[model samples]
Target: MNGCLTDWPGFCRQLQYTGERRLLVLSGEESWAQQQAQALLALSAATSTLWLGDAPAGQPHSPTGKYHTALGREYQHLVFNAFSGLHPDALGASAGALTAGGVLLLLCPPLKLWPGFADPDLRRYVALPEQAAGLTSRFITRFIRIQQADRHVLSWQQGTPFPTLSLPAGTLWQGQQDNRGCLNPQQRHALAVMLHSARTHTPVVLTADRGRGKSSLLGRLAARLLRAGKRIVLTAPNPGAAAQAQAHCPVPLPFIAPDTLLKAPPPADLVLVDEAAAIPVPMLLTLARRHCCVFASTEHGYEGTGLGFALKFQPALAALHPHWRKLHMNMPARWSSTDPLEPLLFRLLALNASPPAPPPAGELNIQWISRQQLLNNDTLLLQVFGLLILAHYQTRPGDLRQLLDAPGMSLAVVFRQRTPVAAALLQREGALEQTLADAIWRGQRRPRGHLLPQSLAFHGGQAQACQFSYERIMRIVVHPDSQKTGIGSQLVHWLKHNTQADFLGTSFGASPDLLAFWHHNRFKLVRTGLAADGVSGLPAAMMLWPLTTAAQTVLPVWQGSFAADLQDEGRNMPGDLPHPVPRVNEQQDRQRAHDLAFYHRDWHADRPALRRFVHRQPPCPSLDEQQQRLLQAALIPGADPVVLAREFGHAGQKSVISALRRIMQCYF
Candidate 1:
């Protein structure tokens, strides 16, 4: 594709070789892209416009009717000025709006020439050839590279006569003057307008298409503010975007990450936000919480969308902070003028102005199922765990084993469609001895498993063993898509229904969200205790819920032993129980039968690994001792000798009898 500006006169002559349908005028602000668009509209063409200002402050009533001008023509151009910045989608959507082989004209300067000009905002400009090629690639059918042209000067500015279109010898003087001067006349006008905004907290926006000197004005403003001891702070989406200000400023400016702005600011009086349009609204909320700030953005051209900027964000700013001041720089100080690729750049990168709202409750589909179900299917397990990995900071392979083997561990997954969208890991607790119960109440060991001696020492508790029942919750992760959607509450309710345990409990890294969720569910705050997790080193809460009349029977016994254990601290031991001797009852019969079946099935299944995994966790209560206690508790129900001597591992019948009576006292 090749052509000269003067190769044709008027619209008809230009259309001879280049169809008037799609014309590309590479003449910056002066480019005839708009003029050529008007000419195409005259011939009943359809057009999609991308303006580089913020999305039209609010919805600006677009020019109506199908015909271009008032001539009753059929051409209808839907202009989307992506004021925020360029968008790839908006560009594609815009191009698609044109008729078959409908013209797509791009207006902007080449990338190579931008640096030669002295504009500080040259960083915002995209390489014209690359952007044009990308657009052509995306909308192949409609966009054909009809022509490519280049020159030292962008467009003629009245009396400049070197070659009809080229700049005159003295034109460089004007360029030099605009480059180093303190905010050109147009920039000064914008800044003065900023002072009128009622919002002293106003964001002074210096917006324009690429090469319009937005950044240069920002740098000049920073230098002036800093010299005035106003404590100017300059920031951008990244350090590279702020490079111009950093290089041009007399003082060394430190760059900070956009995320941690609120807590770690370096005490500044004025904040200068460069390339403000590229950042989303949440970031603007960050700025609003600050003292004073200036937000500078590129309106149209190669930088980003002009229409989106004017339409989407400006009103948000107006409503959120009605006093914001807006300044638009209409003059170009970089290279000669605007880059031709601005329209295409805006179209592709700045299509959607904001994110769509979350799906409504009625529209949301939630699935509830157990971990065992997920584990049986390899695909289901992978999908569930994969979602967790994405949502959580830490989830490991060990967790899968824990889910399968841990006696108390269980899971409930929430699904959107067939996809598991959220999951929670639960731990169903087992009975605890008085000594063990005491240690837990005292915040002694983390999760009680690490403190084994405490279980063997306390001799004054028998009935405490019967009533102890609890369940502990472990990791609870929800999909990012469904977070804050009451899905977590749904999981909690599901757990309560499924487990039907006396008490539900858990300890985890303390987060406000987690804490609030639990608190909302009537999970009371009990005493705090240590529960070692990977991230949080601090102790977590120890809570309980009593389900049966047995709780009334056992609470006092456990409390007494717990108090005594705290007093004893490390100073106690009980005589070992005699060799196990079994007695029988219905409960014992059931437990013995269940255990025997489990052992035989495990042995026959040849699953030594699973057996080991289970045994290693919760240390399956000494089977022989367990059988002896079951037999004794069933036959000698009132006698402490049975529970104490067998379960507590006491050597003599006297001590066992004494422990049993003490525990029984609480129930009586």
Candidate 2:
């Protein structure tokens, strides 16, 4: 354990021979771990090494908080100091950067006591009132168990030397460059598909697991287009994600943010979107319209595993562009396919969590499962967590921790022949004391774990709202393969009869289709954010189902108040001063509306008249649900045709406008 630890160099040589990576776990005190890491660093002979903790003053280090910066950058050795904090995201992202012939040095407490130690990272996610006092983390227990059993993982004890290496044989295919510089036929095929899309203005979605060269292929395609004297723009979730693409491209390509591209799309023959999954799907749909582009994303691992891009964007992509192409790069450019670390990382992070084979067509089983049960059952835990991951864009390992350890957490999973198909994460809140309710209503106090009641009292102007108990549906997700099968609605229907809280409710980023789903499930809207949220760019809507008569009577009054005030308008309308809209003359307004709706086609010209036109009864037959959705979206303050098109199953903005015109024509 002393000296230069000469075995380190030989260990790395073994990795190079096999074309694989290793996970080096240094378990013991921080002092002992740091010494071992320093000695290994001196002898590892790696050109590129990264430190993920408090390093010797001058080493290349990555703070756990900024794990994102390490992504898209390769290193031969990564020294992760778990004593600082065992951040699942940072660990996963950092591990990814460990290319073939690399080792991830995870320094932590001795295996036996590691789980009991208070992880600093947990403090960020383990919310207040959710004490971690007696809770045992199943995630850490499973992680350690796997590490000990794996031949690839070398667990070095405090006083002992590094474990003997048994490097598995893995293949390393040298990519021979063609005229286009493709490494293999698979990559060449992908590049050709992208080229065709660029030429014909067809949309393309390219997916891959981590370490696959999707980003590199994108760069090669960009270079090829540049050779053809084509205008190309590259964009990603952030700059770091675009590094690999930029580094591979000899020609300098301009990088754009997704938001900027959405607001003002640059004129380009092609737009290359790297890390497409990290960006919201709504934005992706808008970008899909702007240019013939290749949207490349990691199919799993780190921030992209939610399958949000695939589940939400691809289906819509197919509908919008029937000729849209799909390509998945299976060959790993950075490591061999049989790399032990890769598969281990996948299971450790639950990156590969997916529904098992679909159960035979039959009745589904819905059952309540406790967090304690989740802690002990690995199969159930992964299925439940994975379903949540598939349904959301921001699902992370911290969420898994919260689900397992947080107070008031409950789970309802739907199974078909023992295979999990859907899951709902529920939390209980509200029923505050009179004094605390008054304080929350007066903005004097903010209690933890009561989002519904706090919103109702603090913003909804309902003083007694906090006194009513609530069961909140934190998250609900149905398997992607089995969706539109009424499984999600079934889960909601089950909750209606099961909950005893005064109010059963949920909060979410509002979309037309999402709102309609809630409405269909008997939830009434109680609060609406006036403006779109800055980060998500989606309006916030809260809906509640009243379980008691008192809640039933109070919720409607709160909705009326919300309707009148237009709450988020407070930024512009300061001092809570009411600015009433003037009434339009009925006869003249009707005539003006007629011109706007049927002939003029300018709803903006006579605003009051257009409002009356939209709100008043139509001369023609009743509007269907589809027509109603179109009208609602059209009336919203800043409805974009691109967004409306995606929401309403239209192919493009022009199609959305045509639909709106038809809906308005009904008024005439």
Candidate 3:
């Protein structure tokens, strides 16, 4: 287009002829990149094109379709500018929108210097405003290496000649077109599997990368099932994802959100779950147990990777239905298998990333590693980041930038040989000036990256806590295979003993098992957020471990305030109830048994005249083990009465109910 690369038309033609997607990297000055993109657009034969980032005026540009909005959309060609800093989520998402024989033209700085260049997105992860100016990331360096290894990627500099296009050897179309309108063999196979599942009342799992037509296959299967006189229900994390599958079905099909479906199910012959990974594992398990369901999810998606779903939910599904079948769609519905952009996106986002194989069975070595050291070692960085990704649901490209560039952040790892089996991310907090501390205490200022101090001063009413230095353990991850082996606890112990901070603290979505783990580490609950977290739909609990005498002086005040707040909130509820006891392990269970035995003995002697005591009562502290078991079974949601009877050696549901009533009478 700029007269330095005249083979552009020929290269585009070859890509279309082979039905392959190719990446055209226009790397040079901003003007050069824009000029090449404009020229390519004029010469190419793409029918539908979408421009991302800042592009030439009068072009079909997507204003809001940067990273996450590209799903459920399709295009024949795309031109993405990385001048504003490359967003990995945007790049991965837009690449999936390209049709077969399309071209993804990327505009960026020269490949060799791109990694070291200042990225604008680094500002979002900078610990301090001063650190934003001199930040760099190893993620970009690794991304450049991946691009260099891909031969199909065409790079254009200031004055280089356009390279000749070389196509990979393979027939793009693998099988004859079926009457069901499937474009490829993979889609055909998926359709057949869905049909069989509907007829046999078996659950099926469908997994594929984006743009694999899995959504469309689901729609066709729904239509076929409906025509066969079967009622079908479609669901997803959001209504829009479910709509993708429903759009292809001719007949009306009801779509429900995953949570609603789990809470109250309607009559249906089969249930189709789209984007299964985005739905919580608990909800998916409920659907699997209650209905014959077909689950469809992208292998690695911008919404989030399905690796966790495969690791945690698949076993549960198998336990519920051993005959369930799995189908994988390997062929891309919109592009060729050899598309260089696919693998590049995968590596850049660490979407398909898995932790390093567990260190050869032995004792793990735990130590703190500097950010510079991690940047210097590519293998170690990948292993550490991969474990972090697996440990949390919200890990993203921005986190990688922080891991490398944040000045106040540090990493600790437990290694087996050279492989990282467990890791923790810690951030320094507090040490705020008097002015800033006063503002935080008054809820006038809330700064980024200082979660522990700000939360304690404003929410927990511990303004003095903000004056002392602290370290917040942001995340602690142990390899799935190494869990329950004390790796996580050992990591926390190492941090507490090694650091000079006045306190060690953490905040996370509350759950029984997680609370037990923190309690066992000697961390006491100090505060709970008023609102539930959007992701887990559960309240967040903040726990603290005092490291100095100054911190110990303020601990009792915070604890008393937290306890009062918990009681007040419970009283405000409709039932004027008390909060449930935190579920800890065998020691607490035994204590509860002892307390309940005392309550049973005193109930008749100390019986109160007012019924108010019965209505506002907390769990019976003196119940026996059997009574506690019966109460738990009756009160917990989804607990089957028949199963409880069998498990607890009761005669039947009648005996189980009788025991539960007797326990309730003692409390009343």
Candidate 4:
């Protein structure tokens, strides 16, 4: 006991000398762990310590483990009281907040109990009928295994003395001398590229790993632009993230949310977007199209992957701005390159995960990979996460936790020569009883997880839509090199045939290309949300493929009622929303559609069909400018002839009808 107490301070001094980050996990009773956490902080030479998680009352100022942004600040030590609850996102966010020579103290129960311990976060993605207790401990099991494998990790068991920690007084690392407006050569070169792009009015894509001073460099750029009296507008997923770049600026930089900025662009000589990957692609395009912009996103961190930015958004960006410049910062800004925590965090979270090598030229085979199998195999796990990151930049650490533990989540990967070429994440949903389905349909109860059924019941005007089971595709991704080769479509087809569900459905932020792809695969158009999705800043779309006879029979009724509801909210509708599907094989319906599309034949007779067809198909690209606007604006059921004429620059109501008729003829 005397020797252990003496060696505790010795470990702290070693950390200070080496400037290395360390992790100390206290696994015991809550009170014991809390006391241990405080004791370590007091013994260490840490000047600033941020305690995260629930403080045992009286310490009201102690930081709770909220999903706060840690970009603009640094702390010498951070105490994570996992005894209260483990927050994956909170942990990931604060990972970089600790500077070198700091310790991340985690307080939790013993390793054996951890796997079966019902974590608070397990309920986040688990929908109804899947309780947290029902979820496997696969995520926690892997987490424990990884930590146990790390010899450096300090572990403490309940009723047991603290594990003796030995520290080596390692040599310190030094970064390069300060260059023009940058701390290192990489930042300096990146700044020069930005300057050139600014002068040439070329768009810029700036990316770097976390702690690489990407935000710091942007701050320097912002300061320079401000000194020149240039108009600068800053934006990010949220104001908190933008503050990191603003920290380097001499003046307070105006920050706007990405969604708001897209809706109303401010005047600016240069627009700098921090954490660009968090914003949806549609909004990013709008910003890029309207201004000379620099989009800076992190390559990897606790937050998520910016590698997906390269795989998904870059191609679209190239199409719009061919002259866009790319810059990457290579060196760490605050911590040493030899920081152990950096690599450990990457390994623990799979933040540095990379996809499989180029697929061999062989037949593709689709197979389901279980969560337990993924937990057991590191290579399989990395490849799965890598593909997820490549497909969705918003793939965060929390998602990794959910992937291994959340109930009803299944993965299907298309393999070629034993390497993943395409992958799909599917979640079982719906299967609601009639009583609950009725309540949902009537707007009395709104449950989580069963997104498709809930949308169908509430928005699609059919309570029976919730009676059937559905396997919903959460995400689908094909290798960047293998994309556009029908691999994605093939995977979807395979899922549809192999899955034993009443229907195979999907919900996503709708885009023209995406909608077309699903439509081509025989999925019918359903509901397009009335409000823009918080994540994508685009309207959500629901589409379904019926596998059973009952699903087919009920779908037709859903189409009519949902179509009526959508037309009621047409003023706020997105351009991507095609009109609802018109009932097929009805003579009156065909006549109405023909009359409305060809020449606004009889406004009274074709009102229903016209409304359905107009909202059913996407905007006509082949139509001339005036004709397209005319079709877009005035052809709806309740469109006012005079208002339509003045708004769309059309001749008159009669002329509007005549033009719509010609337009409908092409479409019909």
Candidate achieving the largest TM-score: 4
Stretches off by above 4 angstroms in model 2 are 2-4, 129-135, 167-179, 262-266, 361-365, 431-449, 463-468, 478-490, 533-538, 548-553, 566-668
Candidate 4 at residue 508, lDDT? 80
Query: Which lDDT tens digits does candidate 3 get at residues 32-130?
Result: 788778877888767778787777777667542345546656777888887766767677777887876778888888887787677666656654556
Please give, for residues 127-229, the per-residue lDDT of candidate 1 as tens digits. Answer: 1223222221111111111122323222322223212322122222134444435435786666455443313546666676544556656666666566656
Q: For each candidate, what is the lDDT?
A: 0.42, 0.75, 0.72, 0.74
Q: What is the TM-score of each candidate against the true structure?
A: 0.32, 0.78, 0.76, 0.80
| Deviation of model 3 at 275, angstroms | 2.7
Query: What does candidate 2's lDDT look like per residue over 65-121, in tens digits?
Result: 788776667778899998777778788878877888888889999899988777666
* Candidate 1 Cα RMSD (Å): 24.0
What's the residue-level lDDT of 640 in candidate 2? Answer: 71
Clashing pairs in 4: 578-615, 579-615, 579-616, 597-661, 597-664, 598-661, 598-662, 599-661
Off by over 4 Å in 3: 4-6, 63-66, 111-113, 116-118, 127-131, 159-176, 183-186, 200-203, 229-271, 279-293, 304-326, 433-446, 571-668
Worst 10 residues of 2 by lDDT: 568-577
Decreasing TM-score order of the candidates? 4, 2, 3, 1
Give the residue spans of candidate 4 off by over 4 A.
1-10, 60-65, 128-130, 175-181, 228-233, 237-239, 250-267, 280-283, 301-313, 531-538, 563-668
Ranked by lDDT, top first? 2, 4, 3, 1
lDDT of 4 at 415: 91
Better candidate by lDDT, 1 or 3: 3
